[model samples]
Target: MDLTDTVAVVTGASSGIGEATAKALAREGCSVVLVARREDRLERIADEIESDRTLVIPTDVTDEDEVTAMVEETREVFGCLDILVNNAGVLRVDPVAEADMADFREQVEVNLLGAMNTTHAALPVMLESEHADIVTVSSVNARHPAKEGSAYTATKYGVNGFCRSLRKEMADEQVRVTIVMPGPVDSEMRDWENWEGRALEPTDVAESIAFAVSRPEHVEIPEITVSTTDKLR
Candidate 1:
């Protein structure tokens, strides 16, 4: 699990947790691939990292074809895949009875299915590495439901289930699966500026993710729940 010279792909690299993760991994000397729908933003983030070790591949995780191609390009360019950070997600706040079906569907597609698409496409390449890690960014909502956020919570719950199942299935394999759940974060997806309690910064979660993957090979950190001390229950 020495991140030095290892290859890592981070989705949703355009902003927030993904951006911080890309920087954090780079600091650990891992080569990073940035994937997001915004090519321009990716380019900007790329400039802040070690250019020699950074690759920007604009991708829509919801599209299986695009995700598959992204993995292929990563392997072709980097020669191996050691880490995958499935951080791409969207949030829609609304009650089920009054919710827009389209919004709910998009949330499911981007938050749940997007992780599946990336995982499916990256598995084969990741297996070749001596040790690999798949870190998915889930939410506390997966375990605790939220008002006007049932649709969003549903998607997180689905992803949590998928990751847990995959973790058991891959237990004997070299790949390690870890789920990172953050209580509330000030990110592009949500505005926590007015919250009465403290909110986690993206780097806080990034460090948690980095810590998860940097553990000794035999020590598995299956899940991490990060929340502000004053967070509302």
Candidate 2:
């Protein structure tokens, strides 16, 4: 999976791990398509990366039609899609009894269905490529249930299950499906000042994804779990 000149679409590229991943891929000479709701932030990142092969599509991953357009635009501009990074996601922490149903629903919509929409749209293009990769950014919550995270965890777990099955289904194909379940990371998703324990940086997770994608075409990395050395489940 040589990243040089390969087009990699990264959702939620406006910030956090998505931003870091986009820049990392650009540095590796991968053509990057940044998809997110914020066009201004995407513009800023594009300028910072200064990659001639960068495309910014302001899209809400929860919308199937927008995702389709994103993929189409990527194809139109890049002529090929090699990697799809389903990094678009959201999180909310609240107990079921006290949680707002709207927040829970938004979590499912963005984290679960967003991945479905983006992956569904990108799969056809990836399947056509000789060597392609689909990397899903999930969370440790998918494996361990944390207090006040039932709804958020449900979406993460749902993606984990879907990707696990898809990985097996595509085992014989050229397309590789890999899941990345990360622990607490220093990103916009959490407050760094209020945190008491260790947290992995966004680039830490980004580098791991890059490593997985850089592996040989004959190898398929099913899953990679990353967290700070001092941070335990």
Candidate 3:
């Protein structure tokens, strides 16, 4: 799983952990494909990397066509895909009893269906590589749910289940699948006023992804849970 010369497709690359992971992968000598709806932000990240090896694909993962195009475009530019990072997600916090159904549907679209769409499209390309890795960014809430976070929890749990099933299917192919669960992160998704001093930084989760991708081919770290030392919920 040496990242050098590898091609990684990262979703939600415009911000948060995906952004950091893209930069980290670039630093490790891996060619990166940045996918998100924000072309301008993707361009900014591409410019920061300053590498001709990067590809920016403005994609909304919820769309099947866009997800397929993302993988096709990555293969077109990089010639192969070695890694797929399913980091695109959305969070809506409200009790099911009082929550708007539309909000829940939106979360499911981006968080669960989005991961499925991208992973399904990326699998064939990954199978063509010598070694491949699928890293999914889940949440601690998937395992330990909170009262008001039902929809978000359901989507993360869906991601966890999807990754596990995908890993079993790829077991014979030697394609590694890893799930990372972070408690909370101070990112664009969070409100700074309420976050205060709590929560892990997006870079912390990004580093964990880097570590997983840098491991030996024989080593498959399936799941890693990370949280701020003080924020034990």
lDDT of 2 by residue, 1-233 (tens): 56887999999999999999999999888999999999999999999999789999999999999999999999999898999999988878876999999999999999999999998899988888889999999988788767778888899999999998988889788998999998888887863333467888999999999999999988888999998777654
- What RMSD does each model have against the real structure? 1.4, 1.6, 1.6
TM-score of each: 0.97, 0.96, 0.96
Candidate 1 residue 203 Cα shift, in angstroms, is 0.2
Q: Residue-wise lDDT of candidate 3 within 203-228, one digit each (tens)?
A: 89999999998899889999999888
Any runs in candidate 3 off by more than 4 Å, and if so which?
191-197
Model 1 lDDT tens row, 61-180: 999999999999999999999999999999877668999999999999999999999999999999999999999999998887777888889999999999999999998999999999
- Arrange candidates by lDDT, descending: 1, 2, 3
**Which sections of candidate 1 miss by over 4 Å?**
191-195
Error of 3 at 190 (Å): 2.1
> Considering TM-score, which of the candidate structures 1 and 3 is the better prediction for this target?
1
Candidate 3: the clashing residue pairs are: none
lDDT of each: 0.93, 0.90, 0.89
